[model samples]
Target: MPTLTLENDVRQFLGSITRRERRFAAAGTLITLLVLVPVVAVADPGLVPGTPAQSATEQAVDAARGDSCRDTLPADTPDYVVCRWLTPPQDAAAVAAFWGADGGANLEQAQPLPAQYVRCNRKTDLSTSTTCKGGTTFCRQLPSGWYQCTDETNGKVTYERYVNGKKQVQSTPPPSPSTTTSSTTWPTSSPTPSSPDTASTPLPTPTPPDETLPPDGNPPDAGTPTTDPTTPSASVPTVTAEPTASTTPTTPEPGNGAADGDFIATAKKARLRIWLESDLADDYLAGDTAFTAALQQLVTDAKRTDVTGVKFADNLAYTGFSTEQQVIRFLNRATQALRAALPGKRLAIGVVVPELGCGDSQPCITGLRKRAPLVTKQHVNRYLRAGDVDRVEIAGGLFGRTYRQYQVTDPKTGKPTSITPALATRAQWMSVKALEWDTLAQIGVREYGLAHTGDTSPWTMAQATAQIEARIGTAIGLGASTITLWGHKATADGQTYRLLNAGLADNPTWNGLTGQGLRGRLAVVIDPTSTERGAADIVHYAKGVSEIFILI
Candidate 1:
């Protein structure tokens, strides 16, 4: 052997090996074909093997012509035009994946091998080959045995099924065509399709009947049979409703103030007072016309109703008088007028007498004492006349005194022990009690009365009431059976009574006096100008008073 060059030696070796390998391969192929041919011939005649015998050129032509093995599928399948078999490896994997390692043996035992493995007999074109018992072919080419079925008409692969090279059996299906035809013809206007229409032609409109009757005439009744046919009976019955009566009372006419029986009973039981004063000066009196009118009306109303008694203060002429004579004259005239006007009713005169010591003096007790006699004599005579005055009240003293002597105090040795002298010894209350008592006695006033000083600066209603009660107690001690309380009224602290009767009924002191023959025996003289004055008078009188009277 000579030394071989690389290319030459390689060529020679390859040529020899090619010849040997070709002979071996041919032998193996012949053996395989023989084995397969017998199996195919003896196996189900419907089963065909190998790819359909078609030229590469012919396959190209058929594909371009849209000639597909898909024609073998039923027309109902969607996109049946694109159905085709899967490749060998994919089919084998599918079978192995589904049935495990023994899947190949089971597939072979099955009636036919898949169409993808069957070779076509080229002499028979699709026309004859397509009608094969177990497989379908087009133009001498076998179709793929596995087709991926899907809903897409665009031929998208969704899922696959291995269709062994076999044809389906034919059976008599239900009347599906007729059913589908009927269902598809249903109304398209609605969401769900409807069945086709089966109705016949509609009838024509009827003509109206002829009527020759009056405008208000009734129509013929359906139940009644026609005889003369001149008149028709009523179709509906008529109903009449009955009227109803109201139970509410009718309102009275406008002019009627109230129903006759609805009036409130007048308060026949009266225990209050009405005080009238004309002491307000001419100008002042003119301005108080309404007050005068109210006073007159109150008196008239009180007289109209039942009352205990009435007392009028007749001292108006004394108002605005600077001199003692002027005051005396005014008091006399007022007393006369009051007596004439209220003849039966008790009338009292209020006197304002000035203390002389108050004029340019220090500790004015001496000066007050000097002027006290003259002042007392004038007012006592003027207001204490018989038939002219019922009672005399000493109104003013200590007109401008701040000294406590005007107030009552206990006497020292050699001093006057009487309350009047003791009270007067004080420049402040000079001649207060003395003038009150002396005036009542000198004028022959049987019913003695006294009012607290009108100067309200130093005296309060409480103090005044206390003073009045003390004086009344003193008079009773002096054998005076009937005494009147003048000035200062009880105020509503909600503890006192509004009426004299109520007060007498409630007070313990007055209750005790009731057994002493003094029940409703003491008279009360109230100054109507004061609010607490009236109430205080009521409380005092109700504690055993014959009458409650207001002195104005």
Candidate 2:
């Protein structure tokens, strides 16, 4: 009893315990490993009842080193790499369902346990892993529109309208790039506008011809009986284009000597251009002495007042002209009649320039291209080469001209070739939904591009400004004298025939022309007519422009 006591008591206690009981006691001591660590061979019926058993801890250590995992994985799998799902004894039966064979279960088998059996199924989404897959981008065309769809893996996706290779093969020429628009060198000595607006950048370095002012729009032989049309008039002051600072844009006051009731000649004489191209124009020029005299008399009356310069504002070369000679003759006749009425006065010509970077999405020069002819550039170049002209100026705002698909009657079929809403019979669309093939609704994105007529109404003020900048840039780049952006409606063309926000009273059109971006680069825009009046503000007289004749 002495100390058989503590030590001997414990020895007898261990010796008396059953084999299965002893294993349980050992497992309890290492409970941190896992709650129910199963010793595999313990339940073997063939083993002797009291034989020693391998410990659970030792099994776990071998598993941690991946020795147990190695046999089930591929032969090339690294020693450190474990096929975790296949290695666990408790999950063996369940994992087998995911992979038919033992060797088939590798590290890449993301799911081992079936969803229903695993109680604490904390499955991670492997797709979110940063190990990215290459080449997720894709593009294709569909009947609805062009689409570029990409990346659903980590949730980066986009389907957009894509312009395709087919754009290269378009029937019309590609739009001109903004830079290097023209071959003609811009003149450095540009005259400033009489308005408060100033120039941002200095004029280009090329010297413009000294101002000979030989009738800005006259044809080669357009001289009056008393004058030589080709000779440079030295007496005329050189219209200088010194740069200036930008100023606040303001509306032009109406009463600057322009008669209140006077309708614009362009609107009243829209058909005059077509006449100019025909034999009728030549006959009129030769025989209509009384009409020519009236034109001279009016000019003389204006000259007797305070008018400093006269500009023949029209779309002279707008669109296709049949022959260049007809234009030259018309210009010559107009120049001869007006030149004598005002001596030593500055004269100018105006025409339309094509649009660049127009529309909401796609740019189309079709409307503007339709305006340009070989004659437009030739006229300007002839004047520039002679060194007989002054600086260039621009006027007017651009509006959007929308074209719709209209229907034409089929001659043989007696049916509409393509049906628009207007053309659709009530029986087709309403009565039979499935049978309806064509309808009048616009198909897709419309071309809200350059404005040529009042057909399209007031563009946003910003669009108007952009249109002005576009025209100015083209006019200056080409060495042209004047650019008339849109046609006029002062005559009987009606309000609908209006051009460039015509019917609207308080137009933001031309407001941004005086902004620093334009004033700094191109001609300053202060003339109420959107022209760069290179003379002093006739009303204010405070800021004298370099040109001899101001708009007033």
Candidate 3:
């Protein structure tokens, strides 16, 4: 068998072996043993020593001939020359020593180098090899024992060697470029001169004089006298001028109890329509003689003050007499008296019929029920024609409760204990619907006043006043331009006294009623009287009037 000492010769001999011929295979085996066995022992002198040299040689040949053999070349070989026989050891120290010192250190540090036997462009290599490309390189064995390669473009290094007796490859990436400036510049010349200074010099302080004049026009010396004859003398004048008294006359303040003229003025400006009522009609007509003078004074005052109208309780005409005939006669007499008393002023007849039972007087109730209606309609109609009564107010319920009651039965006991009811009928001679009758009569007679009334007894004087005002306000709000209050006194004197006193105390002119929101003008009338009155007495008396009379 021929000896195969070189690695490449062994490889070639193995390549020529036949796959099917038994003799050629035997020959190839013998040749493989002779060629690779000695090289394996030389590379690894530490192989087991007990075995026969022949057997050991055969085992080494098997290792080299089999796939287990590694084709490691010795680092001592030049990088450009191919090794024909030598096999290298796998130890890291041996591999590191094979490369140059720097390369060996890098290999020992476990850096990665390019693969052995791979070609790279020379432009990319630092080895001065023509085969390397730009930006790339190849690994080359160094004189010591290790293999290494460097990236030409980035200056990064790679290495291949054995570390701790094991082969390894290592590579390092290049560092990034620096960003700091390389140098700094400085100014070498001076700046231009500044503009000429134009700031002004400060002014010099002035010295004060040693002596100053006193504020009172006298010399600084207190004892020195100002002797100029032209100057006014310091001595008191023979006739000292007194402060000129203010010539503007101040108005005398109004008396504390004086009526508010502003309220009256405002009322007049508003041009409000008014309703008037007197609370003392019944007492006056019962022959209360003192009331007669007072009543006349009230009407006279109303007229003097220019009241728009007056109302009288014609419905209570009989309160002056005990008999029905006397009542009728007194009613006719009172009507004539009021007409004469308030000649030019408007007059209205106010009537209130009893709605409840008469106190133990069935006859009176029956007579009243029948005659009341006739009297009211007759008087209203008669007055309308005569131009005495401008309107008729039909009010009721002086003798009884205005509201009705009904019997409420207990549901469980089936017994009635309480009485309750819907609205009660008003005890007027005519129903509320009958207002058209008087209204139509007023229209026919060319009178402007109309009629409306409220429950008489259940309401107090204040309530009645408020209700009247509200009614008037409503009428105004509803666009009615005019409204009138009508009624007669219980008697002439009583009517006059009540009207004058009430008007003076509570009417807009005297009591500031208009200021308190009682808007409108009022017309009033006094009952008939046989006495005569002087102009001043009438004027003064009329001016003292306050409230009107209303039938309750």
Candidate 4:
């Protein structure tokens, strides 16, 4: 309006503002231009296009999710920088470029630098340690026996030298074979000289019946038999009886032509058994006369039906007794009652042996005890010495199912409390399992089951199936000849039993006993409540044992 001739020379005036101020103004103008983008384009000479603006949050997110390589020097490789990802060759090319390479190289082609030159600390935990700590300074192999971890934060590297999963430590040279005594051998059922050359003797061999003819069967008269006395009496007209068909055994088959009572015979032939808790048979504890009567009746009923190895188990921890003598008395009474009911049949006396339990409660004797495993071993050893225990039925309680959390009533307050009976974590469970099996195994008792009761976490059918499979597989792997399951009543959906069915169907050979009635090393215990379909599955797939014993 004042007739002022403005040159409109922005560059000439831009120098008037300080460099910092000019930059701010340029930023603001650029933002404003972007706000109204495509609507206006100022065509000014010597003006270069500006990059689009981004908010701090957006920039940060981009950076976090960006594919740019990072400074990873002093790493396992001198030429390689860490990339957000280096999977595809195309992506790895960018990673390679960060190392001043012409292009990305194959990730598979990358070789790690030597780790021997830079020793770090050994890991105290299962994880390989990377730094020296606890007076140690060497990255060693993990229990997994795969990679060696280093404590060094920088230049972390792993050297692989595969060996057995558990490290073999040589504390001292093993005593020379000549220097060793013969005491290491497991004893036979019959007593032998304590220091007999036990190392060379095999396990007791089963003796068949004498082959001589009965006195009732008049042998060829002495007058007619004049051959040499050493000639074996003309071989006594050797008889060759035809072998029984595979489907037929000394006992009747369960589903083919036998009654439910025949399940007893089936169980005996298969070495398959099912047992309910003593409470299930009768609310019995400490073996009172009533309890003894009830137990005897239960065995009598089972024997009447043909089941011979039937068992009724109770938690030894809940016996409300302290001294081992009292416990032994209880077991002895039960054994006497059973023997009175059935004279000579073997009974696998099942007992819920726990290393820890409620100090004084219905489920456990309310105080905390540390020597439960040892006590359990002692209890079994005592039972064996008592002469009625055929096999020690080790209930699954804590050792069998790791996924369970048991609830018990606090005797003093009458309140429910949750307890983790054994190791809860899967890793811990595996470790404990190995130890538990070894403990019982070392005692040389015929151990039946690392069996489970029905209590478990709510899991999908597939999950339950997999877990049962894993549990059974683990028990078998641990040298358990029989894998028993209890507590089917805990799962209402029948998923656990169904999953068990699927496992049996998947592998009949796992049973170790089939229709042939030839006893197998692997026996799977079933619940009395198993679905009809589940039972059929076991019967169909049964290899060594076609019969299943229900946990009553």
* Model 4 residue 125 lDDT score: 23
Q: lDDT per residue, candidate 3, 1-552, as tens digits?
A: 356458778787677774323323433453455445545644322122222232101112122332111121112112232222333332322332333232223432443433343323332221122232343444566543356666556766775555454665566422222433212122353342231111122212212111111110111111111112123532211110111112121111212211122223323443433333332244355465734653564355445353555554444432222333344454455557666777766665544333221211233334333433323333333434444456554332122111112222332355642211101111121122222344443321100111111112222233223333223332222223223232211121111112223222233212322333322333322222211221121232233223322111
Worst 10 residues of 1 by lDDT: 213-222
Models sorted by TM-score, best on top: 4, 1, 2, 3
lDDT of 1 by residue, 1-552 (tens): 455587788788678784324433433453344334333322211101121232210111122232222222212222322333221221333333332212122333353344332212122222112222322121111132222232222333232222343333222222333343211122333242221111122212212111101010111100111111112431211111111122111111112221111111111123433232222233223345543453353345334223322333332233323344444454454445444545465544444333311321323433332333223333334435433555543332112222223332222233322222112212212222223444353221112112212222122223222223323332333223344443233221111112223322233223323434544435544434334432343444554555544422
Off by over 4 Å in 2: 1-286, 317-323, 329-337, 353-376, 379-493, 496-505, 514-552
Q: Which regions of candidate 1 are displaced past 4 Å?
A: 1-310, 314-319, 328-343, 352-377, 383-387, 394-403, 406-412, 415-470, 478-482, 486-521, 525-543
RMSD of each: 59.7, 34.3, 58.6, 30.5
How accurate locally is residue 176 in candidate 1, as Cα lDDT from 0 to 100? 39
State each model's CA lDDT, in order: 0.30, 0.28, 0.31, 0.32
Instruction: Judging by lDDT, tell me the better candidate of 3 and 4.
Output: 4
Q: Write the per-residue lDDT of candidate 2 for residues 184-293, one digit (tens) a residue.
A: 23345434323211123221222211111111111111011111112354121111121111211122232343321121222122211100000113223345764454
TM-score of each: 0.31, 0.28, 0.27, 0.34
Please give, for residues 31-92, the per-residue lDDT of candidate 4 as tens digits: 34333432232221111112122111011101123212121111112122223222333333
Tell me which of candidates 1 and 4 scores higher on TM-score: 4
lDDT of 4: 0.32
